[model samples]
Target: MIFGTCGQRAPSVGESAPAERRKYIEEHFRCISDCDMCGICAVYHNQDPLLVYRDYIEGTRTFEEITEEYRR
Candidate 1:
């Protein structure tokens, strides 16, 4: 999978990502500068970060709710 500045795996040719994923990509992934200082894209290389934040993004769970689960 080709990883892009969007900090997620890029959709293949002719394939489209879900609206939520696209929104996240557009809002959070698009780099503002030439510096690749943020390592978030690298995290996507190993796993789908979206899965971890799905609940938070979908409004089903608050940030604290999801983070609390991991804190345990």
Candidate 2:
């Protein structure tokens, strides 16, 4: 898949989207540096913490599912 950012050329086909996104996050995303290992970011961000950090994955969960309890 081709990964892209605004004003940037799309990654060549056959590149890994997860790997590309992971690299971008590591270099530019600041909260990752001081993350307390708390699970809140997962719920708040609607992503799975383990998949995101350990496996460099994204879009594993949704806002409705993460905040389901609070909406009860």
In terms of lDDT, which candidate is strongest?
Answer: 1
lDDT of 1: 0.50
Using Cα atoms with residue i matched to residue i, what is each candidate's TM-score against the true structure? 0.35, 0.25
Best by TM-score: 1
Per residue, candidate 2 scores C-alpha lDDT tens digits across 1-72 of 222223343222234465664555444333443457634454437554334443333534332243353334
* Candidate 1 structure quality by residue, lDDT tens digits, 1-72: 334454455443234335554465456654445437765545445334466556555565543454355446
Cα miss at 64, model 1 (Å)?
0.7
RMSD in angstroms between candidate 2 and the native structure over all alpha carbons: 8.7
Report the poorest 10 consecutive residues by lDDT, candidate 1.
9-18
lDDT of each: 0.50, 0.40
